[model samples]
Target chain A: AQTVTQSQPEMSVQEAETVTLSCTYDTSESDYYLFWYKQPPSRQMILVIRQEAYKQQNATENRFSVNFQKAAKSFSLKISDSQLGDAAMYFCAYRSAPSGTYKYIFGTGTRLKVLA
Target chain B: DAGVTQSPTHLIKTRGQQVTLRCSPKSGHDTVSWYQQALGQGPQFIFQYYEEEERQRGNFPDRFSGHQFPNYSSELNVNALLLGDSALYLCASSLNSYEQYFGPGTRLTVT
Candidate 1:
């Protein structure tokens, strides 16, 4: 009964600028995993970054980073120095940690547009 | 090594018809998961196959079935399809870790 929420339906940022996409989730499990995935117009889903609930330190992958506020139930994606290639539909996902539990609940995506 | 791969990139089916989608997991991956992504929406988990058996499933109906081969490849079968069943079917592969690698997805259009 876990759910992920992406408040923004669409977002736009100028090239070289930074953009942040917001996401929140509802889960009862203390230990879990959060992920951000990007789907381009080509319809390929690509993993952007991931953060574990136990890790206090946020996750960062080059220009992509996540601001994970466990208590607030918020996990946001921050894209630095945005490029045109970064334009895509971004989805936030939640997965439980227990064995035999592989269901991944996802949020309604937020489409990102990078302007040149 | 190649990432996850799906067969018949596009498929068109009519109402009440049945369809099957195939997936080949990435090298060394033994687990495969299937997801359904509707237009303008995120992908929803349908099921996961491991060790040639179903390990997990979502809130889908019984009409949505699947099978995993000995090679770790998998197939998603949808019987008596509905118009609402039209979506992008994605296949993901993983080891014992939580991280999963996704395929390009098969676009299914049910008319």
Candidate 2:
């Protein structure tokens, strides 16, 4: 079984500052996928970034990046120069690869608030 | 192209009643997966449908059933609903890749 955990129930960040959201997962499979999804108040889940276990390098979007410590089973999200628009409920997810059926197990979530 | 779409934006049902939620996958998508999102929590995978057949399922029991049509549209059926079953039901469409596109979701309330 694969389980993802996001320890911070809530987080706050000042606009233009940076923030980090921690996530860790337990999976026995060596090949799998990790993801960060942002769900705004509108309740729409948006993909933020994705990382593959096979890759040693981390994944980064425009303002979002992930510190994927595979050995430690930690995949954390980092938002640089945070913007108010970034405020949302963020979820961390795990999907096994070979991807044997494309089902994802998600973490509880961390609500992010951007303060101006 | 339009993204995934779910029907009955909201529904209210009593305990022991049954409910069905519909979904239309994004254009050109052939796979559909269903998820249940309780208040203040991440969405939980219920099942996935492909080629009009069930490809995979989660820990949910037979009480949570689903079907996929030839057109790639899907439906999630929950029988003998309980108050614990109240949640937002989401439908996601995807290609062979791991990335998936989600719908707005149908909010179900079991009183």
Write model 1 residue lDDT over B16-38, tens digit each, in one string.
Answer: 99999999999999999999999
Model 2 lDDT tens row, B41-105: 89999999989988988889899999999999999999999999999999999887478888989
lDDT of 2 by residue, A1-116 (tens): 88999999999999999999999999889999899999998887889999999999999999999999999999999999999999999999999988565899999999999999
Identify the candidate with maximal lDDT: 1
**Could you tell me which residue pairs clash in candidate 2?**
none
Off by over 4 Å in 2: none
Q: lDDT (0-100) at residue B85 of candidate 1? A: 98
Q: Which candidate leads the pack in TM-score?
A: 1
Kindly report which residue pairs in candidate 1 clash with one another.
Answer: none
Please compute DockQ, using alpha carbons, for every candidate against the native two-chain complex.
0.84, 0.73
The value of fnat for model 2 is: 0.64
TM-score of chain A of each: 0.99, 0.97
**DockQ of predicted model 2:** 0.73
Q: In model 2, what lDDT does residue A24 have?
A: 96
Give me the displacement of residue A28 in model 1, in angstroms. Answer: 1.3
